[model samples]
Target: MADQIDDVDFALAAYRTDGEWVVAELTHDHLEDVDVLSAALRRFPGDTGTLGLVAIDEDFFVIVRVAGTSTRLLLSDVTAADEWELAASVLDFLRLPDPEDDDEPEPAGEVGLLADLGVPAATMAELIDDEDLYPDELLSEVARRIGFGELFDDVVGLTSA
Candidate 1:
């Protein structure tokens, strides 16, 4: 697992359990910190589930975990523009559902999964204002699309109204 973790850049602490790849935690000194990215890579244990990154430029990174295997691309060489492009590509690749599907789904209501992820209500509201946090319906669609089914499944239990 440790050896597998050493292969990526920008990976910060990963672990595997019951054949599920879990990126336990990650930290970045700055949006573009290389050492932090290196540390992140070193922390990966091996791919079994999925590797997800909430990048600075609205970019999301995904890795398919498999033991002793490199199932994803290295992040070290990606430019900011590329990262955003990759993020969009990944989201599209995963076939995340669109927010506009089915009459917009009532503005996602208030009980959103992002809130469950510990994003402050005020902050989330602000993000929504800026169109950063997708509407609830779209968010759910995206969550399922991004291989966060487990996390999304547990969202109701994790959030507080």
Candidate 2:
């Protein structure tokens, strides 16, 4: 399981520009760095509004949005912070501590990461409320709500939410 943890299957990024959504590829090895991710998003060739999506070992996921110097994050599983380097880095970014065995996945520093963008964190919390859905499915629902569901599914080859 530890060896498999290093092989992540999805690392995609996109940003809205002039009412258009643009995508760019991100390497799996660099998922732990906000600066690298932010830099990549900033170079997306348009306005600075950028959002990132990444999954690890199909066990957990991350959503990051960057605007100016402020970066926001949402992690699918907070317990992952204790095991995965990527999750640990995310918690570090938000100044959160690793959780105990019974801990639930919740927003650490802020709950409304996407509230300003129209998708409320409360709504997102309700979406992932079901533990049965994988990170991709939860993210799929997120894309659907934000009007990029088809594009996201097409790019990621996932059809169901």
Candidate 3:
């Protein structure tokens, strides 16, 4: 699973402080498990909460939002649980059943996680449903919607300059 853990393309924690969005790179160690990731996120001070955006192997992504003691999660592709330890851990954390080999790839968890922020669940669903885009791209869109596209793009190297 160490090899798979290393497959993380990027892991970031984003939050709003004094009405401004702050994006920071998360340590790879936090990528080992969902609980650890959540705990790590809580350390960040934010007006709303902390969002952990993790893209793995360019195959799928996991979004975790932590506020106080509450944590909401989203997995871009549930089927990824079959082969990824991190994905599987997300399912376990959510108390969701593991995906079968025949199960279709779909997101799991609260799509409305960012509803109160501005990006409705419908918009998030549209992004997640587009199979052609990579996890980083989808995450970039989310950041863009929430007011930090440039910062996110710069961190992920999606922007040229």
| Number of the top lDDT candidate | 3
Across residues 1-161, which tens digit of lDDT does each residue of candidate 2 receive? 33543567677887788888766657754564666666776656546568888877677888888777777788877888877777777888888777888887664544577776667878877866778877778777887777688888887789745
Can you write out model 1's per-residue Cα lDDT over 1-161, one digit (the tens) per residue? Answer: 22223322342233445665353445333123332333345445543423433323222233222223333322211222232443333334334433332332121223232333344445434443444442332333334444454554344122311
Deviation from native of the Cα of residue 126 in model 2, angstroms: 0.5
Residue 2, candidate 1: alpha-carbon lDDT: 28
Candidate 2 — what's its lDDT?
A: 0.74
> What lDDT does each candidate get?
0.34, 0.74, 0.91
Q: Give lDDT tens digits, candidate 3, residues 1-161.
A: 57766688999999999999999999888988899999999999989789999999999999999999999999989999999998999899999999988999999998888988778999999998998888988889888888888999999999632
Q: Which residue runs does candidate 2 get wrong by more than 4 Å?
A: 1-6, 46-48
Per-candidate TM equals 0.32, 0.86, 0.96
Name the runs in model 3 displaced over 4 angstroms.
none
Q: How would you order the candidates by TM-score, starting with the best? A: 3, 2, 1
Give lDDT: candidate 2, residue 129. Answer: 74
For each of the candidates, the C-alpha root-mean-square deviation to the true structure, in angstroms, is 13.0, 2.5, 1.4
